[model samples]
Target: MTGHAPRTRWTLRRRIVAVLILLLAAFAGTMGVASTLALRGSLVGQLDTRLVSASERAAHAPTRADFPGAVGSDAQPTEPTPSASAARPFSLRGPGQDVGTLNLDVTDGVVNAGYLDDNGDFQRLTDAQATTLAATPADGVPRTVAIDGLGSYRVIGATSTAGTLVVTGLPTAAATATVAKYVAVEVGVAVVGLALAGLAGTVLVRRELRPLNRVAATATRVAELPLDRGEVLLAERVPDEDTDPGTEVGQVGAALNQMLGHIEQALAARHESETQVRQFVADASHELRTPLASIRGYAELVRRLPEPVPDTAVHAMARVESETKRMTGLVEDMLLLARLDAGRDLDRVEVDLSSLAIDAVADAHAAGPDHLWRLELDGQGSDGDESDQPDDDGPSSGAGSAPTLALGDEARLRQVLANLLTNARIHTPPGTTVVVSVRATDDVVTFRVQDDGPGIPEPLRSRLFQRFTRGDASRNRAAGSSTGLGLAIVHAVVTAHGGTIEVDGTPGQTSFTVSLPAA
Candidate 1:
């Protein structure tokens, strides 16, 4: 099963702003709720005060007729008339009266009341409503009462002038409307305030975090640099002003700059060491060539001397010649590597790789008769098509001409194929099958050397192409092997031709692939 990629997370600026916006929204909501509640209580309190004042006026209101005795709670009561206002008692209600008035008469052991509904019509209270209103204590303090068909009211109960229990009330619609208006206003203001806060917060936060972005941008640039191999020129660094050590961002930039500086110094030292090594090899190869030639000449001269030399002396001279030849090959390989490191130019010519692989495999078969060798051309034909065949000179001598060609030094290319074949022959046991396969496409060419024998061990394969790298005593060399520089020389020459080479080895199969760009 395939795993999904990780989700991209929010940026620091956006995340921080989101949290801030949530906190502000919560604060605004809480404040709006608190404001609405405070305003509701204030409006209710005012309405209750007005109700108390109206009740006081009705409790001692002017009587419709004269009574024989002072009216008190102890005397018999009569029905009470509802008033329009405190100042204009018994006056007809006008447009100014938004306050609903109510009067309840609890007299003669019965309860009756008349209250104004929302339509301004005088509505007689039901017996239950009257009883509920009359049951309020006659303490002259305001209390809440609900009359059917209307809404809630703030009412005050008192003893009327006729010694009956009377209650005066005002519907709480005005106070409720005032509270609602405040709530609406609060909502509008809260919305606008939160919107403005979000916009301003975003802009300010982005500006404040720009320094951190600068630091991050520098890090990204460093990450993109190719610092894994070769001479690393780390000339890039945080600017001087950015690298000040005072602020947080400044301190980070300064520290990064210091680290980069150290890395540059280390790379310079490493490059210096490599340069010294290359110079020594080049100078040593040039100095040793003459002596090696002299040694070979002296051995040949001593071996060809005129009369019957002892068999022992002849054998010693032959050994000296062989050792000189091997040393000469080693010196040549080292010199080639140094020259490649110095970037010496090579002769570039159109060379056919199919011809080269065939020639090299033939040479390998002749040299190691115990091993099987074959060449497989990978472009146009593998079954000896007339067009892709090679002649005595090269692949171009075929009936139509070979198309699998590359641009490189022909002698160097031949040496590379020869070395690969030699490595395969020497490493594998007798009767091993070795194949040199050539593949050519529109933009590139590949030559793969494959063998079926006891393949290269995993542990030594990684360093197989390094200078002086050799196999174990049993697998390193065959009878006529001169030096272990075969694979090393192959790698150096391939790289100098601007190509690549790699090897893959297992128990029963091993393939070395050399890829070169097409000319």
Candidate 2:
């Protein structure tokens, strides 16, 4: 099977209008032909009736005594009279090979007659038509025929009182000529109508597509937005207020504008994020260099000593080792966050989150026994409503079950718990209770770590998850253990498991919530 490549194609409104016009013209032409034919038939019928009436009037007319002959024979007048209007001559033929003549005259508003020889051929008629006329019977009836001298005519002959065939002829050429003239006019009218319709259709089509043109122009301007330079400067958009929401063109323009807005916002966010990442990397490098240089300098001093080192020198070397370990830990945490930012995949398994939280709280208590630790595990089917608990109960569980079964990389989840526990341990003073609680629902599992320590300050809360961000400058100076990367690593690990972590801090309490998707 052959596959088609994707391509953009434009639809021309003018062509569509042209097609509609052609179809209408075709339908109109058919109707015109039908109407013309019907009119022609009616006119021809009237002409035939006129011919029959003239024949009947001639057949009943009184014959003059001076003209006498047998039916289908010729008669000649002894005296001839001249008149301003000359007679139109005609002939009638009988079935017995007899022929007669009639000279039609309209002089001074009176009909006159003359006779001519049957041997004279009709000058205007074709030979074939004249022969056909000559074969007709001598019966008294009107017959239609073509004459050599007269074109097409209707004729009738009957035996008069003088025993001559009284024949009358009416030329039909005038009726046919009139119809031909009408047909030419009809064709001219149709042509003019088609041309005007096409021109009008083109104008209408363009007017209808004006909105689409506006949309195209908007898109062109949007394409020139400075997204690469970390700036968004697109302004032109189709006006939603004026456009009809129901039309296809309007819908398309609206949808395009919506998509463009979304793209602009996303680009702005990405640029801001990139700037933050750069700053983080710069700060982290500066922090790492101090410890690294100290370790290197101490090692060099121990190697360059002229004699065996004293206890003071040995103690100095141990401090250098401790600083090296701290530096290594900080570096490892930063590397883990970088990997998570790069979307590195982690090994996933089913781990009991309840067990994990319990272990973390226990370790925090062990590290700082002066700081009170609380563990609340809402067992299965217990009404774990945190809202119903008394204020003195400290941290409580939400409405959910224990043993939150979550599918995730267990090591990463443990790391997230450890970071939260460590943050609570270092920030709070003695006697401040740190609480860890676990709750599960049908589709998600949540853990909350709250502390009654000097909660995070408002100004510093925004940067709590940022790498190397410390809540209190005094705390940083006092404790070298807090490298200010614990919460950042916690954020990375929780996010890697497709979870959300939130930090809410106030005057007397601070809580960190991590919610993960259930298995």
Candidate 3:
């Protein structure tokens, strides 16, 4: 499996869930805490009321017999006093003291104390804990004590009989337990509530965004379409249900659908216009062929006749013949372009490029012998590991090596070469040197035509391969005549053969580079 990046920040669903949970938790926590605190305070207040009642009862209502060493109401004494004879085991005694409570009685500052246990037996308080209780004053207000071996106490002290003080205390275990239990329940409920809310938020957010997803999918399909050339048919659109303009998502969907409609209409109109132009070119080229042939034949016949025609008339007839042929060539070029535009397929075959260059260069030299011509080849990395093969058309015949080959129509490829050479020959000066280089790599072959002549003017250089573009001045000014379709035809043919061409130049040097896929 491939590694994927994890989202560091929240998504839309997560953001919604987080915000809603935050608000919910804040509100529920405030209420739960307020109620818990209120319950605690109310329970503790009741406990304090009971402690006050015990303190008051001990102050004025205890019988005189309720003193240390007094016997129980229904029986004789069961336990002896701690101050009794040494022979008896030490025991603590009190007068009618009750279990289930704590009792502290002080006479002449001498203390007697014990705490009631679960079995109703009195357990004596440790001396250190007893001393701590004694230091408290006989005030009605409650106090808390951390007694040894006894968890916590809420205590209050008050005066009893003559110079005697009484202390009453209660454990706070029940009240503490009640508050803790309530808090636990509240936290559990809040956690469950937040989880459910987060789940519901994610579901709702996904459902609501479905329409937008559909819109994006449509746009993505359109983006993947090939729209650069040929007829374009854009038919994808936002669905009807999503196109209602009332809601925000609906508004977006409606707008996108409308834009797609307009684009389809525009493309349809453009395709129609291009079709009409192609048909017109095909028809015009067809109509002109017969008349042009007749004009040429009549001019040639007039020249051959020995009727002693005037020299001026013969010269005029020759010009007419030449112009007619030029016009016929232009028409044929237009017809070929129209057919290509109409998607006519060319013949596909294997052609050796190095040999083709030699032939084209020879023809160019014959046509314009004043210009110096040369051929360049790729022998840069031939370490003898790559065996040489013989090629009938390869320029490297004398060098005992094969040449670069490409998959294309032989006739069209030759036409491309002829156009490029003719373009260079007619445009560059007589003494300018032209070089044709054929280079082969693993998957492509490049044919570069370089020249040392007055370069293309800067104003026309950018559109040098566009149809009808003419140079400000031709290098061979004495033979300056052009239809301006040579480079354009070169571009169209190269492109149809799955190739690319680029031109670059400065004063005295210019290069036209063409790249074709190797067979």
Candidate 4:
């Protein structure tokens, strides 16, 4: 398998500066190369012009007496004039001839070549160098060639009227030096310009992006708020200067501000709707209790009447009493939920959770004797004694384990346990074993209720603690009625006490854990 290369996430500022520098360098390099080439061509053209003049002068200058030979002095016969120590000066070594100028004279298949040095001294060429110069055709057109001991030269050949061939050349050292120096200066200037451009571009880009950064900061603040429930005050907004809508960043800032305003209005509407619904449930539940209690009392009175009543009427009264009790419980649960939603403060007092767990398990066993119930402390089983049970005032310290204390309302905490146990009992079959446990850590006290039954359905696990979320056929095996608010009340109570609840619905190991701040 091929591995992907890691991508570098360069910020906008860095990317802009880098591209700017690269473009500047490319432009500078192109211009430098073009100018250098032009300068070299101009310098070579001047050398070629001088070469042609030198060739013409050599072709017309006076020659020797015996034959057309060396000029400028009175000396005649010579076989091979290979050295500059001749008594007579060479014909081409006259005035107006520059330093490092080369000449070749060819007559009757014989060649003589020499050059003038920087000190006005004449120097003879080696046989190899003379052969290279002689190869230049007498075509009057200049061409560049490299000699043995000399550097580059621009040479041209001309045929004199005496049928003698003259070749003249000049060294190209000055022009090459000029171009090299120019290149050095140009490269240095380009480097400095690129650096300055990069710096200026970075500063300008950062300054231009400041407004976008501000908009992002505002968005980040809004994202940190708790907008999932309750009355949320969305007061964060982009600054007015950043919301001009004229530039790109400004347009983004303006759009964000508009979106935030819309979200604030939506949150306000949602809070208002939730408030009205909660108020209605509270009022209705309050109005329901009196009538439900009165109906139950009447049914009980009729069932215990002194006079004889019909057996059918007696059975109907019993059913009515049972239904009334169920309705009363439902109303009470709804009222408690409404109060919790309204953010009512609960009594914060220290309570031993280990003793509370033991008492709750005892009560659950009494209520559901068909299901096996067990109590544990810190993961170890505990045979809870009556003496350790909590009294009407509060929980008593239980033996066999240290008391795991938590800060919460005692009555609400007790109700939390009762609801959890009732949910397990009403949902699972008779053979299911339910375990209740309490544990404490340095920061929190934990209460866990686990049942070894068929796990909850996958679809229901997400909203299991939401109100009126009943179990499906896989878990609802028992005939006992379920109003579906048991887990909801447990969750609401835990949250009101500044705690958290979580569930694990692994098959045959469903568990709910509540964590509260330790006292």
Candidate 5:
């Protein structure tokens, strides 16, 4: 057993939306990161400036017990010696650490101080001269140092006093947390803004694509058109009257509608040409049949004469005679169609189609003694009549009293049956069974002829009813028969009588059905 394949899927809409959202997200993310970095840098720079100013003021401050100017009746001043600890203001805090001071000793022309804390605290002096008071610096310059166990710091030497340095250290944790907080806020805003942007993008995309959707729908309806009808029924044309010609979709719709109009006109012309061809065939066939029939009859008469006809003459005459007969048959078939086209008035008598069918089948069986013939006449009722009066030429048995009656020409109808029977006899092999059936309802009558024979070849089915179209050309040549106008006449007559004929053929069986209006 074979399994069905999965259907193909399309994702144009989803892909479009996804791309738009991705672009918005990328833009938002870049902007948010840049903004956050700039804000954090500015905040940190301001904090660093404050730390430097506080350090400068602390470095220049006087000792805690300074006298300034003291007076006792007359101003008497005593020289004051600064305390060693106060002068240097250096306090070691283990691990080579110092508080309120920075060690500045030039060893190998390089100043080395272990570390300094944010509150003027330093530690981890590495040299003996690291704690000594050095000469006053000519210019104040802050140098960066790493405390013994802390992070990096900046220290500035004072110009007013020796060995005095203003120390300020920056902690990694505090600065890092401040920057992280700024980034977090920025990320949150970016996420929310990206979502809103995506929503807006979707709405904008749909609005922008609305006109295209209309164009697509119009195109789909046009594509579904039945071009064989020679007319386009696209009531909904793409509204291009007001659209800009330069727009992509507008141009497409305009071009398609233009093409459709051209196609419809071309189809109409083709249909007119075909109708003319069928008319010509029907007319020419009618005009040629009578003369051909006369020629064939005369030729046959000459061959049948016994007035010392030579053998060569007889053979030649026989050939001419057969050809004439074939040509005559072809002409008669065409003429029948042409007469129908010439609007030959129908007799319009209420004839029983079922009775006609039974007689036709019986006649076919009698003529083709080697073949089986079957008739199924459905004697169903028509309007206001339970019984149909059978004509003398019609069936006398099998068909019930109440048969399927139709409003038609009885002689032409019989001719139709004869053509069908002859066609089946000629096409099918000997001993093939032929089935003839008639069915009737209140409004319609149907006659069917079926034969069990090597059915019509597939290649010839399309043009089976066309004038001069023969299925087995070789057979026609061998039998010296068949002008190929029988089905064409059948089609024309049925159509003229406001009826329909159809053929279904396959290996071993072929069926022809004609449907007409019931009386």
Candidate 6:
């Protein structure tokens, strides 16, 4: 089997134009061929009619016997008397005989041929040309023959009253020239006509397809919108002019408009549903916090009562208190997420990222003393205050030496760092080394939390920051149970601050990076 390459697909405009041109060319070609053939046939027919007439005239013409002092010879008289000159045969230059008229008289196998020149003078034919003329059958029917130097002729043979085979012809040069000129003119006119037609067709086609182009532009704009989340305002629609259902393009435009309308309604319904759910979660979280606190307080009271109680009861109260606190934390996380989803405004101010990193790492160290903690401030290890550092606008060793400051809600930003550090501490095994780094550039501030431990499971990486997404037992080695909302909160807070966060988890290393616009 042989393979063939795929042909390139042509656009609608190109295809339409090409088809139009091809059809025009075919039509023009057909007309040209028919016209040229008709013209050539008519010219040949007229020339043959004249040839027959000339042959008849030459047959009846006066011969040498009719002239005095000229007898039994095919030569003209060199010094003929006035009477003999007057009796000479006049058919070659006679009335209605055009230039280049050929005449031949054959008597008893002797042939004599001559033709009229352009100036009406008689010129004898060469031997070959005369022989060719003599071969014309004396059937009184005209036929075409090519003479050596005289070109082509339409010749006919007829016997005269005096028993001479007379052949007469007219050169076909004028007819051939006429037909050639007609063909040239026809071709030129056809070329110009096709060119004009092609131009007009292209303009008309483009004008007719304007509605389709506009519809495509509308679709493109709609596709560029961010419709994945939030309240999407699907306002893009094909224009009214383009949406008519009368024609093919109009029908397509109308259908697309209808589809867009349906999508808009569906999106509005979805957004409404999501809004209701968020409101419910927020209300429930807010309403449950006080009761949870009350329950924890009662549990504590039961444990510290100055009365004899069963150890099992005390242990049960402790467990109840722990569970209540955990529940309270979960409620708080949900409420915060709801607020963020609602696009609640937050306090924005310049906060030192370096200081935040130092505090977060120190806190992590306190919470998980079993793990090794490290901090890098602009590639220089530091666990100290950055408040006393020189202003970034002033000269410094490098840009990284400047305090990394970002404009955002201080509390939310701090929480972002806390969740990241807590995630690292809880997921990795004991004795794992965790690093916190902060760096500054003219445009942005960036921080990273990296740990050398069992990396996140591959299956959990895609939705690692999604709410309620928990790592499996292999990645979670801390004492506390996983609530799975820590990274989710981190992601939400960072996004709310107009920042971005990403995680890279390999076999033995995990790193989280956050970038924020500089203050």
Tens digit of per-residue lDDT, candidate 5, span 449-506: 9888999999999999887787666643764445677787778778777899999998
Which is the better candidate, 3 or 4, if ranked by lDDT?
4
Candidate 2 global TM-score: 0.44
Evaluate all candidate structures by whole-model CA lDDT and list the values in order: 0.76, 0.66, 0.76, 0.82, 0.63, 0.82
Error of 3 at 66 (Å): 9.8
Q: Per-prediction TM-score, please?
A: 0.77, 0.44, 0.62, 0.86, 0.57, 0.80
Query: How many pairs collide in each candidate, listed in order?
Result: 0, 15, 0, 1, 8, 0
**Residue 517, model 1, lDDT:** 82
The C-alpha stretches of model 5 lying farther than 4 A from their native spots are 1-18, 29-244, 261-265, 268-272, 300-322, 335-352, 379-420, 439-448, 455-469, 473-476, 479-481, 485-508, 512-519
lDDT of 6 by residue, 1-519 (tens): 999999899879878988998999999999889988899899999888878777777888876644332224433332111121122244775676789998777654445567888987777776667667777777998788899999988888888888867788899999989988988898899889888988998999899988899999999999999988889999999989997788898899999989999999999999999999999999999999999999999999999999998999999999899889889999999999999999999899999988788778777777887777777777563455322222323211122445788999999999999999999998899888787788888888999999989998999999998888988646653436678889999999999988999899998999999999999
As a whole number from 0 to 100, the lDDT of residue 100 in candidate 1 is 64
Candidate 2 segments exceeding 4 Å error: 1-308, 380-401, 474-479
User: Would you give me the overall lDDT of model 2?
Assistant: 0.66
Top-scoring candidate (lDDT): 4
- Residue pairs in collision within model 4: 64-69
The TM-score-based order of candidates, best leading, equals: 4, 6, 1, 3, 5, 2
Write one digit per residue (lDDT tens) for candidate 1, span 399-474.
2325678899999999999999999988899878777778888889989999888888877888888777777645
Candidate 2 residue lDDT tens string, 271-302: 77875885586568657877687786777688
Candidate 3 stretches greater than 4 Å from native: 1-11, 17-35, 38-46, 49-169, 177-204, 241-251, 276-339, 349-354, 361-407, 418-491, 498-519
TM-score attained by model 4:
0.86
